[model samples]
Each structure stands twice: as structure tokens, then as C-alpha cells.
Target: MTQPVPTTPRPAGTRPPELEILIPAYNEEHRLPTTLRALGAHLSRLPLRTALRVIDNGSSDRTAEAVDRVAAEGVPVTVTGCAQRGKGAAVKRGVTTSPARWTGFCDADLPTPVTAVDHAVRLLLEGWPVVVGSRRCLGAQLPVRQPLHRRLGGAGFRLLTRRLSGRVTDTQCGLKFFRTSVARELFAGVSCTGFAFDVEAIARARTLGVKVVEFPVAWSDQPGSRFRAGRDGLRVAGELWHLHRARHGTQRPTP
Candidate 1:
């Protein structure tokens, strides 16, 4: 395990960052650098103050080194580590620790284009507390189709999630954002620490009365996905069932 490198701490009384984008990486030495560069370039043109943090999720490769290299190039990148090896755990750690007004996580492969962050920020500024990218929504375009087995598995997952959460399609989409405070509160109570975490998050949001809007996004099926359709899919199914049984009473929306 590589030790986390230190970065300059924010000065006291300094205004918190407007947005923090967390990319959960596991053995993404080849793909993460490109994603970070693209994200940095896109964020530079926007006026909002932003920071990027890559959560190294127990990656055995030099993913952390790649992040350090990118940061050296002035890409505004930082990194943290999660001993637990799950995307949900990494994202939860990142979001909970972020001081930014808005925070979110996207796939390391950037299946949804980095430009989707622009739309998410706009929605957050417009009083939407939770904004998520969706490939199953109307107007969404998938440039590259997923393999048939993956597509079938996704459909089944979506169906199961809808039954549990009601009409919320595409809970597994890798890009999602929330108001930082709200996100912290939500993640603090999160139970699932695996791929099924998304389903739990959305269900929790609904129980808490947080309005979640799914924005149609242009997405592509990227190679090197770590999802194991048979193994992980069954694990996710079990998690969903547990979420269905858990009692989550309605709570007041975060103000």
C-alpha cells in the first residue's frame, strides 16, 4: 500500500471551494490521467472555483503516482486513500471529507463526459440539491453500446431498483452530485459500500425528501470496466434486497 502524499492545506478563514469532484480509482493508472486532464481543462474554462480529488481505492498500481504527476502539472488535483476496496467506500470517504459547497463523484473512465459537470453545477445553483446523470432518460445518447450481457444485467438491475424506489431509473449511473452538506449527512448513514451503494443513496434521498433530478447525458461504454456482471451483480442484488427491508422513514429535506 502506498502512503498518501501530503498537499498544502487550505488557509484558515479562506472560502471553501465551490465544487469538489471526486474520481474513485482502482488500478486505473492508464485511464485516470487522461480523465483528470480532460476534467481539469474543462473546469478551467468555467468561472466557479473548483478542486479535483482522486480517491485511490486500494489500487495496487501507480494510480496515486499518476495523480501526483497531474497535480505537478498544475491540474489542481489531490488524492486520498481508502483501505476498503469498494467504489462506494471511496466516494463516501471523499464526499464526507470535502469542504466544498458542492461535491460529487464520477467514474474514473469518465463514461459520462466531463461536460456533464457543467450541467450539474447549473442545476445545483438553481436550488436542485441532488443532480444525477442518467443514460436511461429521454434525450440521453449512448454512443457505444454495452455488451448484450451487461445490457441485460443493467435492465434487470434497473427493474429491481424501480420496484424498491419507484420510477427512479438508472440508479447505477456513475456520475452523481449533491450539495456538500446534504451529501455528508446522507453518506454518514450509508450502509452499502459497494456498487449497489448508488441504489441505497437514491432511496435514502427519497426517504429524506430530497428532490433528485436525473439529467440526460451523453455517455459511452468505455473498455476496462471492473464490474463483474455475475458476481458483483448478485452482490448488488443482495444489497438491494437489504435496502428494501430496511426501514427509512420520511424525514424533512435538508435546508
Candidate 2:
């Protein structure tokens, strides 16, 4: 049963948040509170008035209570529900609802460090439309590597998505920031709502001529991830094919 949820955000009145970081969680009652506190602590140091938001993807656990508990500690946490349970759907809900100047989503486990948020906001202020954390970029560190099967799957997935995602080295990084305007534009017409959503978002960015910056970070495989390569790989492949078909069908014929 769903318990009564958290607070209406502390209204900033005319001024919007300078940056809003979104945590998309599904059944994360055990793990999410730590992420919320860590992120809130880091965000507090930024010069910008940052706010934290969570997209509760219809979790059956006590996820909502965890968010409220974290917020009660003086960290501004506002959580919204996503009946559609998927990282992509949660991200869509958060980005579409955000009015902040800068917005982004990180996984509940947050393989990328919370400190990366400061650099992300800095890059957004420097006029980069999108800042994407990359495991494939130089200077990236994986203190713990993914199992070999997963790593091999990742490489094949990249090859399959190359055309749609442009030449972006890593599109599936859970850490990504966007100028709100760019995020709104890119995600507004998107239809994918799976793990493959990042690929679709990147593809849309290229089509619109918005630049995406890949920032290397110390990202690692986090425990308790919901994704199962064996079980979900076909679904992601199907989504990718659908994206290709949908985009291809809309193109104008060459002269």
C-alpha cells in the first residue's frame, strides 16, 4: 500500500532553483536515503541555490518516507510519483516538471560521485547545453568493474546505437545534466521509456544541433541495480530498433 507522500517544495516564489538534481528510484527504500543525504550535503556547498527532487517510480517499499526523512534534515527534497516504472519514465517526469535553470538525473546508487554535480553546474553555466558523465572518456575511473558479460554487452550496445547517438562515447552514463531549455526540447517529443532512453535523448540532441559535453568521472558498477542484461537486453534492442524506425520514417527523401 502507498503511504501518504512528502512535502510540496518550499516555494522560492518568483525565482526558480539554479540547479535541481533528480534521483530516479524504484523500490530503493534501503539505498536511497544515503544518496539523498550525500547529494544534499554536496549541493549545499554550490553557490547556486540547488534543490533535490526524487521520482518515485511506483515503489512498493518505504521509499517516500525515506525522502521525507532526508528532507526533514534541512535538505530540500521534493518527490513526485511516476506510475510508469522505469528510469526513463522517472527522468521524463522530473525533467518535464523542473523549472530550474539546470536539471539532471543520477541513479539512486549514484556510481558517479556527488561532487560531479558541482562541475556539471559549472559547465552548464559556461553555456554547454548538455553535460554527460562518461565511463569511456579519458580520466574516468572504475574502482570496481562490471562483470565481463555486462562489459561485452555494453560494447555491442554502443555499436548498435552509434548512428542514433552520434559519436558520443558513452550514452548510458546514469549521470547527465542539461540546460533546462535543452532538456525540455530534447525530451518533449521522445517516446522511448526504457534503459535505451539515453540513446534516444542523445540522438535528439544531435538532430537539434545542441552540443553535448562528455565529462570523465569516477563511475563504477553499483550493487542492487535492477537492470538484468540477460532478461532486459532484448527489450533494449527492441527499443533501439523502434527508435531507428520512428526517426527514419520521418526523414525527408533526398533530392
Q: Top lDDT: which candidate number?
A: 2
Stretches of model 1 off by over 4 angstroms after superposition: 1-15, 248-255
What's each prediction's TM-score? 0.91, 0.92
- For candidate 2, the C-alpha RMSD (Å) to the true structure equals 3.2
Model 2 C-alpha lDDT per residue in residues 1-255, reported as the tens digit of each score: 966534356666646788999988888988988898899888888898888898998899899888888888888888888877678888988898897989999999988888888777778889999999898888888998998988999999999988787768999989999999889998897788889999988888887788989888888788787999876888898999898888786753221
Off by over 4 Å in 2: 1-15, 249-255
Q: Give the alpha carbon lDDT tens digit for every residue of 1-255 in model 1.
A: 766534336557867778989999999999999999999999998888888999898889999999989988989888888877788898898998898999988999998878898888899999898898999889999999899988988887787777445556788889999999999878888889899888878777877888889899999999999998778878787888788777545343242
Kindly report the root-mean-square deviation of model 1 from the true structure over all alpha carbons.
Answer: 3.3
How high a TM-score does candidate 1 get? Answer: 0.91
Candidate 1 whole-model C-alpha lDDT, 0 to 1:
0.85
